[model samples]
Target: MAVAATPSAPIFVVADDHPMVRDALALSLGAAFPGAQVEFAGSLGETLMAVERRPDADLVILDLDMPGMNGMAGLAQLRSSHASVPVAIVSAARSPALMRQAVEMGAAGFIPKFTPSQEITDAIRDILAGAVWLPEVARDHQLAPVEADLALRAAQLTPQQHRVLALMAQGKPNKVIAFEMQITEPTVKSHVTEILRRLGVQSRTQAVIVAQKLGMEPPAAKGS
Candidate 1:
């Protein structure tokens, strides 16, 4: 029988806006996965770019509340663009519902920001070994069919369209989205039309409702 090969030094991207949290996780990862290559990002855009630059990275530890995330929308974008790279959610939110939702959305693991460094390391190791990791609080979870379908649709969006839809989900008008995204209003309108089509929704209201399925109010966490 042949033995499978494993990476001797794993590469990781830790994406969090807070410098302290990002540094702390890097330290923990370095200690746990000796000789591991760790990169950092402060927002969803930066995270996406970093992962794009390192598509062969072993893992991505993502922060759910960072800028440009707009809830789990960014996750959909990342998974859409880089299906081969594994992603893990590390958030302050300890909600079992959110954890289960992440798993259903194709996350490799869900780690609470408050989890001890050792546990986080263990979770990473397990995920890298091809196991799905979720906290104990989220063990017996199930997903609604509607939510699963929504995640699937969201993952089909192109990166730019996903960003437009995220802003739209915030109830932003086309002009506002254009200004925020530094694009023209007409372009925003085009994106909206395509977003509605991809989501199989005929109107902006229905599209927002679909976005809301993956939406979340930011959670407050200590030391995060």
Candidate 2:
């Protein structure tokens, strides 16, 4: 779905430690939405400063593992300081616990660090439309309350893809996943690719993030 345009362009804030990653994300957003404005922050201090300077950001894409101030802590602070601005967790950690924590902490959605550009755009659009972007399992398990449509959409994933997603969320590499599942490395690679496609993510980190948002646990090793 396309993001609805407003008379005033929506402002965005992105906080991440890696300069290249931050720039890449900004570039991707710029390409996707030509008129929108984005502000970058490399640390929590910088993020706070940017927010103070421009208290009109419509969305904040937050990284939860930054130096000095952890992502969750920063998020809490941001919420306290700017209660109205919506926040989205965009992190590398894919643990279900973390994703649950993000929602409980009042994030509008949880977007994985490796999510594809299109998925990221979709998430932003959805959030702006006042819809939460959580996975179906998370809703079913009561990890978070979500829209029925989001839950139904998540339920469409295949069982094998679900297993693959669970393993990836546990930080398992493709080779380790292959060995544990008794599948060939190439097969694992293919599954990983398919999982990313299904999740609308561009990288493993993003896929793992999405898996956690769905309330998925790590897959058991082949022999337990």
True-structure RMSD, every candidate = 5.7, 14.6
Cα lDDT tens digits for candidate 2, 1-224: 12334556677888887788788877777776666788888787787887887687888888866653433445667766787888887876655445655576578988877777788887778887898876443443654443332333333444455456666777788888788768898988888888677556689887766655554444233234
- Per-structure clash totals for the candidates: 0, 3
Clashing pairs in 1: none
Record all residue pairs in model 2 with backbone atoms less than 3 Å apart, i.e. clashing: 64-71, 114-206, 116-202
- Lowest lDDT 10-mer window, candidate 2? 146-155
What is the TM-score (0 to 1) of candidate 1? 0.72
Return the TM-score for each candidate structure. 0.72, 0.58
**Model 1 spans with C-alpha error above 4 angstroms:** 1-7, 48-56, 71-73, 76-84, 93-107, 114-116, 134-141, 216-224
Candidate 2 to truth, TM: 0.58
Note the Cα lDDT for every prediction shown.
0.80, 0.67
